[model samples]
Target: MARLLALLGSINIGGNRVKMADLKAAFADEGFGDVQTVAASGNAILSDDREPVFIETQLERILADRFGFKSCVMVRTRDEVARAVADNPFHGEGPQHGSDKMVHSIFLSQQPQQSAFDDLLELHKSKGSERLALGTRVLYLDYVYRVGVSDLSNKFLERKLGVKGTARNMNSLKNILSKMDAE
Candidate 1:
């Protein structure tokens, strides 16, 4: 069995609420083992014998069939999760816990096209303070200034790339990795 992290897109937002317990039960019913949820924002860690792509598709189908909603989920293996953390571009800028700088990753279900990449790079050119880097299946966003006012937010990425995704803070990413390690 391989451990994977499923980052659900747009769950519990805009009245599309999904209970973590229900999500866990859904995965368990599908025969996944050591299932765990990090926060209510739809982060789940589970072990399955199936491939990551298969599991991702099955999870999306199950949510639609059983839960009555279609959710775009991005599934990443344990190694991929670790790499996302390790390959961060803004790790050594300042204190990680509490500081003016923070890294947020937009976990995308599908890799954005070249046009989308160009748009992101073009946006970064105008906004030098905001640093954006492309990962294997994630987008690393380094917010050096006001996070609340930055244009490099999750919504911004979605609109620019035209892909469904969910953003996780550095702490949340670390916590998920810790949970995966524990499993």
Candidate 2:
């Protein structure tokens, strides 16, 4: 079995609460061991017999079938998470400020094309309050204002780029990587 981290999109963001305990139970029922949820935000670490992609697909299907909605899921191996953290371009003083909340790291399903970066930059230019730094499989965003009020939240990025992704705070990102490292 492989240890994998799965980030499940909001299944209950609007009120249909899918408790973390229920999610862990679901995974356990599916034969996944060591199932643990990091936070109420749908981060889960588990050991599974299948490949990551299969696990993601099956999990998605199960969620939809059980919960009656489709939610995006991003799965990455422990090594991938560590590499993404290390490869972050704005790791210096820039993200340490209070505005760091505006700083986001987006995990993509695959490496975006070169043209995608240019297109993304154009989109950021329109926002006028965000700076974007592209990585191999992540996009680093720094906003001039708070994240919720900023024009560069994950919804904006997804809309502009037409890509499926999820955003995580820097501290959460580091914590997830640390968990993987400890294992």
Candidate 3:
């Protein structure tokens, strides 16, 4: 079995909530092994013999059928996680000024189109936010306002691009990566 990390979209946010235990059981029912949840926010680590893409497709279908909502999930191998963290575009930059909880990263299903980057930058500019960086498959955002007050929600991007994605704080990301590494 190969170790894989799945960045699941909201399973417990808003009115739609899925129990972690039920989610894990679903994966096992679908033939996955060693299924583990990293956080309550829907990050999962598991071992599966199936191809990542196939597993993702299956999970999406199951989630939609069972939970009555559809969200994008990105699956990556252990090596991909390491590389993604190392490749973070905002490697050395401090958070934007006057911001409480500024750092944000968007996990994409694939490398976004150039037009997507252009659009994201334009959006940030219009909002008077200064710092924005796009990496291989992640977009980092720095905000000047408190994160709760900022309009940079994952739902906004998902609607803008007509795709599904989930956002994670930098600390959560690092912890997930570290756990995967230690495994």
Best by lDDT: 1
In order of TM-score, best first, we have 2, 1, 3
The local lDDT score (0 to 100) that residue 88 gets in candidate 1 is 79
Off by over 4 Å in 2: 92-100
Residue 8 Cα positional deviation in candidate 2, in Å, after optimal superposition: 0.9
Candidate 1, residues 61-161: lDDT per residue as tens digits?
Answer: 98888788888888998888888878877655534455423777778877888788887898679766777788766888777665788876677778888
Error of 3 at 178 (Å): 1.8
The model with the greatest TM-score is 2
TM-score for all predictions?
0.86, 0.87, 0.85
Query: Mind sharing the TM-score for model 2?
Result: 0.87
Candidate 3 — which residues are off by over 4 angstroms?
96-101
Which consecutive 10 residues in model 2 have the weakest lDDT in total? 92-101
What TM value does model 3 have?
Answer: 0.85
lDDT of 2 by residue, 71-143 (tens): 8888888887776667766554354464344456788766677687788788657657667777866777766
